[model samples]
Target: MPPKSKADGAKKARVPAKRKLAEEFPPGEVLTDNAKKKWKLGSAVGQGGFGLLYLDSSGSVGADAPYVIKVEPSDNGPLFSELKFYMRAAKPSLIGAWMNSRKIDYLGVPKYWGSGFHEKGGKRYRFMVMDRFGVDLQKKFEENGKKFPRKLVLQLGLRLLNILEYIHDHEYVHADIKASNLLLSYTNPNQVYLVDYGLAYRYSPEGVPKEYKEDPKRCHDGTIEFTSIDAHKGVAPSRRGDLEIMGYCMIQWLCGRLPWEDKLQDPLYVRDSKLRCRDNIDELLKSCFPSENLPEEMKKFMQEVKALEYTDKPNYAKLRGILLQGLKTIGATDDRKLDFGVSANDTGPPSIKVRATFSRTLKRRGRTLLASHNAVCIWKVPPGSWPMPAEGYLPTAVIVCNYRANLFNSAGSGW
Candidate 1:
């Protein structure tokens, strides 16, 4: 795909162009004039090392349109690093799994559109397009007066745990898991979507596969308050570290602040504080644990968290139940109105688009083969076309697809 040029705009007006199917395309990809004219960007939502996030109003509204656009400054190093992570690891590690597994309707992950670059003022900017949500968990907590109900916090923890479990099963770690990174889908308030996989990594036996690891001294990733103790100590991250940070975030969500928030001023301070806190771990745990007024399930959950040893932490599913119970209690009394603006009325077969970018050798097989190393494959499904199965899993027909050509034309071919 060629980068969108001014001439492409003229071509789109004459006929519906195939390349114009997406309002935006990545750098080197082309967009038709019709798409360029139709796609309108809304308010800037947030910004990070990756780029800026904007509310997008392009294509059709509701199920047919994309709701958010992430704009990356063309030549920014941090933004490029973030984009590379998304392009190579983040999208495929998580979104690819959901799409491949036919779990598009899963409640806690973002539905990604394609990514693209836009040139303005003679400078190129990279951006990723994804489904926009109503608000982030941090915003929701603030709206509730900066104090989330204990039950709701527990529910959020459970949902996040399930998402983590899924990611871990696929051999990846969401290194930057925090409240701000979690978004609530407008269609379902209870449904949480995990965004910003910029720091995500796939775990290798030799540890993070070399290519993804950044220098601990020069490159620090993750929020100060939510980062794990080991991470703060510049240790190579493991699944345990991810869960530990999650545990801390859960405490912050329920209590409105973390135990070390007042004591730590920076990552170094946080590291030292963790050592001191660990020396008196019982006292610190007591301060962070929920009060007696907390729900029974939540109280049990907190106890479990306190008892979590590096060698014997509980599995995510067990913790998930406790969190879900807590959230249900809080949601029952939640005064926020549920918004179901995006209706699933359209009746059509799910549109599946599979695109592959390969960097290694390809082997020929009679009619099937697995995705090779260093390969990026994308499969997109329009909403309302494929409903999640009653059992919560998508059908094989919906999940299986090929790395090349129409991968789904035949069934039972695993990637």
Candidate 2:
């Protein structure tokens, strides 16, 4: 895409438009010259349950950045559910947006640019323009032979955790959070974005806490494998439900197969298949728990997760830390450097000063592009090592040394 012009950036920075009925037209609908004048349509990208996505050609020219134009046939009910959810949920200050933009870098959730309607062959179609996220997590997993590197898996886990935390915080639930819905930045693999809010909903609309409410026909709203057990029962989802689904996704990524894949062909067999994989599920949970080998803060977070009772599980902060730590642990390599220096001066009396600097680097795969420096100071030395100087004599000495050390400790020997 061309560099974001001042106008484009300002437009991007604006809060997404609220849902409006006028914007929701039936198929065979045509945009006014004003709306048509704003965007130039390009080729189709892909389609989802709600609409077809196309590349935008209008706006500042020469900007290769593509915007997805989502077109829904007019006969379908007003395409406002997803748009409503997107508008309510797309604020950068919101926890979900922050975690998504910073931690996961999942850019699947594109920004809303503009919307319009068109008519072709007597049918009305409504479309909205959004940023086009390139590849998805599913393709990446397949490219890695079904099982992603542990580090990448952990990074994915953390990103999902952040997304869940943000979603739950807003009293909403991402009814759908799966690999296909998870988008990646075009320029970076570590960046993962969540897209397609069509299925998202307020967690506790009407003051009713979200609980799983099963509907066999809609059982597939979210991907079958990544969905939580309660979701199959048709209960409104709880925050844990989202986390549980995320947990399943992580295990699937690590194992190269979904827990219920064998039974996936027959809906009746899915629950049993998941039960059969209980041991694997427990192991996955344990893998994410905190330990001495992991970052201390992360371990503390695992402790928090362990402490949570079924009804008392809304600790977004702890969960976020745990997921981040797990992500860091995957393909974690630590580099530490220690520097020591000494200075002395003498005249009538003598004095000396000593200083040390320590630094560490933690590396992980998959989310390396999203990495940021986190540092802590361990110790400090006081100054007072030299005597006072005399008018006729003066002496000084200085020593400096620096060394590097590897501090990373992992549960497994390799990824």
Best by lDDT: 1
lDDT of 2 at 153: 57
- Residue 294, model 2: Cα distance from true site in angstroms: 14
Q: Give candidates' CA RMSD values in order.
A: 22.4, 17.0
Give lDDT tens digits, candidate 1, residues 78-111.
Answer: 4444444455444545666665674544546565
Clashes of each: 10, 47
Model 2 gets an lDDT of 0.49
Best-matching candidate per TM-score: 2
Residue range 47-133, candidate 2, lDDT tens digits: 554456556645532336465566777545435566666556664345445655555434234455556567766666666666667
Local distance difference test, each candidate = 0.51, 0.49
Instruction: Point out where model 1 deviates above 4 Å.
Output: 1-50, 57-65, 88-105, 205-221, 266-268, 276-281, 289-314, 321-415
Model 2 spans with C-alpha error above 4 angstroms: 1-37, 57-63, 77-79, 91-109, 119-122, 206-208, 211-221, 275-313, 327-415
After TM-score superposition, the amount by which residue 310's alpha carbon in candidate 2 deviates from its true location, in angstroms, is: 7.6
Model 1 scores worst on lDDT over the 10 consecutive residues at 3-12
Query: For every model shown, what is its TM-score relative to the native structure?
Result: 0.58, 0.59
